[model samples]
Target chain A: SAVISQKPSRDICQRGTSLTIQCQVDSQVTMMFWYRQQPGQSLTLIATANQGSEATYESGFVIDKFPISRPNLTFSTLTVSNMSPEDSSIYLCSVGTGGPNYGYTFGSGTRLTVV
Target chain B: AQSVTQPDIHITVSEGASLELRCNYSYGATPYLFWYVQSPGQGLQLLLKYFSGDTLVQGIKGFEAEFKRSQSSFNLRKPSVHWSDAAEYFCAVGAAKLIFGTGTRLQVFP
Candidate 1:
């Protein structure tokens, strides 16, 4: 399993501002996933970040709104653009440990509050 | 499409009591099932997961889950509930990308 260090553990920003959340994995991985967990809601996949390629966003999410960067196998960043109160949520980064029955490792998460 | 369902939105149990949290999932093939616990103001922790072989899998913190193929279910259980066990539980199904259930919040009373 890999350990992820996600920073800005939390932040408060004004509406229309943007925040970039970073995740650094101790070990290299092929794909990293970004998720949004709204208050009192289940986690939703925002996008899949693959090294050396443009991130693949989920249907309801877009690159402009939630741009992702996977500069390498061990690091990725997700930026929430043009923030609104509705954008307030916990953002998490995850990586799958490759094996027959491997599980995914998640970052501590970033709690963002848009005022 | 893969989807997970946790019918119970909230559950309350007395400390030291046995606990069970129901989870159901829909997927086309043999699904990768997982149970994760999220404490207040903390990250999501993987409790248990079922890939294959054993129908009943043990996880950290005395948590276990049984995967029933026919029922399309993967329910989490614990022999005794502790105060620290109170948290939000999510059931997810998938391999690369996970589809999570709405989640069940557990409340333990002494």
Candidate 2:
């Protein structure tokens, strides 16, 4: 099992401002993913970050809006740019470990509120 | 593409009563199934997973899930419910990339 620590547990930002959330894992992992949980909605995958490679984003998400950085196996960051009220949501960092059946270990999550 | 479906959007159960949350999936082959629990303002915690072999798999917090291939379902069960168990539960399927269900919110009443 891996322990993921995410910073800025909760933050309030002004519209047009940007916020970057950091995730640090205790153990090195091959796959790190970013997810967003909007108000009263299910979690949606924002992007997949592999160390030393460009992040792969899912449909409807662009690198310009959500830039991801995976510096190494144990560290990654997700930045929400030009935040708006719609960006108010919980951003989660997760690491994929174990085998094919193995599930992911997630960070506590960052709650962002845009005013 | 892999997708998960949770039929019940919200469930209310009495404390100490048995509970069951249903999950169904759509995938080409036998996919990895998982159940996760999320408390208010907290991250998701894995309850159980079913990859292969035994149909029933046990997990932490006294939770268990059964993978029924015929029905394409993996339902989470608990013999008894606790007040602290009131939270949102999600079902996910995949290997490297996971597709999560809409989630079911459980409300335990004393």
Candidate 3:
């Protein structure tokens, strides 16, 4: 399986501050994804990080608020801009190995708490 | 859009007993279904997945799931439960992005 490592495992930030979470993969491949898990809730797809192209956000998520940057195949970053209390959740990064060969693997996740 | 549903929110079973977790999906076309397990304060791990062919699929940790297209269901089952099997299990369906169920919390007693 793909191994993904994410930065800032947990953070507590002020309401007006912002946080940028980084995810790095061990191997180069396509189809990187960002997901958010709200309090006691299921994981929701935030966006798909396509290398050398803009990310495709989900229905409810927007690009401006959650700016995603996929510099290359092995790295991607998700920035939570102007965070609020409602933004407090666990942000996860997943890496896929093309088709169903290896499936998707998630990082330890960043637990963000906005006050 | 693809959606997944897990009927049970919580399940308690004793060690050496059989275990089952039910999941249903809604998609017009054939969809990829997956079951993931998460331990306390840990990331989610893929327990098993059903993509195409072979209705019965075996996965890690002595787990298996059957995909029934007619029933729109993919249920996880194990013949014998281990105390270490206690965790939250999530069922998902997708292609680009996954639609996940609320997850089923399992508790095992000795």
Candidate 4:
């Protein structure tokens, strides 16, 4: 299993502003996933990042709205652009441990509040 | 399309009482099930997962889940509920990309 260090555990930003959340993994991984958990809602996949490649966004999400950067195997960043009150949610990063069972490790998550 | 369903939105139980949280998932291929607990202001922690072999799997915090393929269900169970066990539990199904259930919020009363 890998441990992830996420920055800005939480933040409050005004509408129309952008916030970038970062996740650093202790071990190298091939793919990292970004998820959004809205208040009182289940988690939804935002995008999947692979090193040196553009992220693959989910159907409802877009690259412009939620840009992702996977600079290397151990680090990734997700930026929420043009924030709105609706953008307020908890963002999480996860990496899968390749094996027979394929276990996944998740970051602490960033709680963002757009005013 | 893959999906998960957690019927219970909230569940309240007394300390030391047995607890069960229901979960159901729909997927075309062999399903990989997982249970995760999320505490307030904390990260999601894996409680248990079922990939193959035995149907019943034990997890941390004395939690266990039984995967029933015929029923398309993976329900979480605990012999005795603890106050610290109060949290939101999510059931997911998938390998690389997961589809999560709505989640069940447990409230333990001492």
Candidate 4: regions farther than 4 A off: none
What CA RMSD would candidate 3 show? 1.2
List lDDT for all candidates, in order: 0.94, 0.93, 0.92, 0.94
Report fnat, model 4: 0.75
Candidate 4 RMSD computed on C-alpha atoms after optimal superposition onto the true structure: 0.8
Compose the digit string of candidate 1's lDDT tens values, residues A1-115: 7889999899999999999999999988987999999999999999999899899999999999999999999999999999999999999999988776488888999999999
Tens-digit per-residue lDDT, B80-100, candidate 2: 999999999999998878889
Runs of candidate 1 with Cα error greater than 4 angstroms are none
**TM-score of every candidate:** 0.98, 0.97, 0.96, 0.98
Q: Which stretches of candidate 2 lie over 4 Å from their true place?
A: none
DockQ of 4: 0.86
Order the candidates by DockQ, highest first: 1, 4, 3, 2
**Candidate 1, backbone clash total:** 0
Candidate 3 TM-score to native:
0.96
True-vs-predicted CA distance for residue A37, candidate 2, Å: 0.4
**Cα lDDT of model 3 by residue, B35-82, tens digit:** 999998888999988889899999999999999999999999999999
Clashing pairs in 2: none
What is residue A29's positional error in candidate 4, in angstroms? 0.5
